[model samples]
Target: MKKYVYPSEISGTIAAPSSKSVMQRAIAASLLAEGESRITNPSFCDDSLAAMRVAEGLGAAVEKKSDSVIIRGGINPVTDTLNCGESGLCIRMFTPIAALTGKRMVLTGEGSLTSRPVSGIEGALGQLGVSVKSNNTLLPIEVSSILKGGTAAIDGSMSSQFLTGLLMALPLAEKDSVIKVDNLKSREYIDITIDVLKKFGIRVDNHGYNEFKIPGRQKYTSTDIAVEGDWSGAAFLLCAGAIAGSVSVTGLNSESCQPDRAVITALRKCGAGVTVEKNVIHVKSGSLRGFEFDATECPDLFPPLAALAFYCKGETVIWGAGRLKHKESDRGAAIISEFKKIGGTVKIDKDCMIIRGSSLTGGLTDSHGDHRMAMACAIAAMGSSDAVEIDHAECINKSYNEFYDDMIKLGAEIK
Candidate 1:
């Protein structure tokens, strides 16, 4: 779908969307738990839904409600083939879980997820006595045998997601497991995973992000969990407020382990009016100035940070461009190419993304089938001199399905 966003001032408050990262992890944990688990404030986004489907495919009885999901856990494997539906996390995280069934299972995904690398999955699972075969290190991976668990080594530089799977699945192994990680990135995401594991009565010992120790013969105890608001999606709204007008976003935890909470720090650094009162975060337009942010641990912040930087006075430099390569799209390249269409100056140098602050003379942009790219372009368009038309605007449904509606409610002129 294509949508045009015109320059307009926005005001009023909106509730942040539920965190799919948390919701998906909770779903995986619930699938491993023996009893019924109730998850409140869940996100029904595409990725989360993919995780739910995978949970159900692996023999969990899932019941969806208006605002919650009830899951009764088991790993009986109702089908040999599980479709992950364009969710990278689902394919990577659930591969290990599927091996717990001790049955031959095929894990496949659609769209961009099909092309994403499954580098560490095969090697790590091999060490744990699970046979894994992939499409030349990509998706549509086949797994057989059980996760007996022992010592495994994986490189964590590309992503910490597969490691999260190990941490979650190893506890149920017949023997204790130890994972040695090298060059680990996105450590905060592991924190979120461990936090979710704790809720399900699972335990893991982390040794300086380099290794994890898990005791075997542990059982997951199901419990009710409440999903927190996503800082990843809320960053775009806050950036919109910083560029156009005032916006107060509620439902975000003041202290979240999610790395995107650094958005607040970035806003303050860029001279935006930011006030935090418990769960409510208010950001207002101010004399915006360039800021420097190292997104090494929070690479998802790149898009919104890029948008926010466009309206600043000088130049903003965001580090960690190297991490954007294997995302939904080549995020760094997409951001630069799309923003160039809208009169924004952005360039990537080595591991840094440099954006020169300027007023947006909007034109047509494209989401490149990336959710964050779509939201960033829309937010950046709000302060443009002309309307910015974005192709593939519907892509935001992956993470924030109501993003356009929320912007419209906040007075954005979108058509």
Candidate 2:
């Protein structure tokens, strides 16, 4: 456990970390491309590393440098087992790609991922002519047979990643494929996948987030791509600035397609002093008023938005609680439970999360082994009357490993 206390006023500039979402998808695309793909500013977070490992297991040669990674693409299948290292994206995205080889491959991971649902993986892939067995929809899934591209009706309410895997895998099938998605949440993530695929020389036709048409027997052409800064991770920093003091975060793409970029809208609605200039976002402490937000598309914003709501006036209601059940934690409950320890009042009703702003009396809380929960508590603690202690603080490494160090650079106090 680590305890954190913050100075009343925090001020500085910090660069945002690379987006793991983009980096992981790029790694998968690189594995399917025929030649060497150069990825600049690659993320070294655990999740990104897991994707790299998965690529290598499937027979791609990965060379790592300080600032970039070189990947030579081919499905050589050097290993029969792929360890996803607790990253949900790695498991969901790579399982279908593995099935493309028509060989037995076991997909497993550590920690919460072992218990996370994979029925979507089994059901969706099974429909596409792949044999899959799982631990009652959990990890350690065994799959075989080459994927045959056809029509698959996928339930997208739970996650968009399953659709992403199908999109990435179907292009190589011998026949054309069509994906019909129902209630597709986080559609922007799928958009990111399509955008990355287009950059790698693959074509996918998306029809209003409902249906996707993919032509089979296509090849991924290698190219040099730069991974953008992560808005999901940077939202915590921007929230910290809103609640504690003024902070400027650089390197975030103002035109980023990342769903979590909606953080700025929430902050502005709550009366935070926010301004976007060039490639930087400046957030400063200001008088705040609670505002309503629908996080159906950008569910990752719930944590930081929840934390920011605690400092705003009146009650803030965030929609889309249904989207939180399968994340790193039951994030809706985790946010309500952890924030309660700090003297914040939060409640969930149906698909809505309600937060009543109040002064925080920082106290001990557990992260529920969730990265966003830990960072949310840490950021909320900054404006609290006392220090906050977070158990299993290291869980932040699953995504933003340098979270605390980045905060410290912007004048956060921790030990």
Best by TM-score: 1
Off by over 4 Å in 1: none
- Local error of candidate 2 at 369, Å? 0.8
Q: How would you encode candidate 1's per-residue C-alpha lDDT over 1-415 as one tens digit per residue?
A: 9999999999999999999999999999999998899999999999999999999999999999998999999888889999998888888899999999899999999989988989789999999999999999987899999999999999999999999899999999999999999999989999999999998989999999999999999999999999999999999999999999999999999899999999999999999999999999999999999999999999999999999999999999999999999999999999999999989899999999999998789999999899999999999999999999999999999999999999999999999
* Model 1, residue 95: C-alpha shift (Å): 0.5
Pairs in clash, predicted candidate 1: none
What TM-score goes with each of the models? Answer: 0.99, 0.98
Query: Each candidate's lDDT (Cα)?
Result: 0.95, 0.93
Q: What is the clash count for each candidate, in the order shown?
A: 0, 0
Candidate 2 lDDT score at position 3: 52
lDDT of 2 at 177: 93
Error of 2 at 385 (Å): 0.3
Poorest stretch of ten by lDDT in candidate 2:
1-10
For all predictions, the C-alpha RMSD in Å is 0.7, 0.9
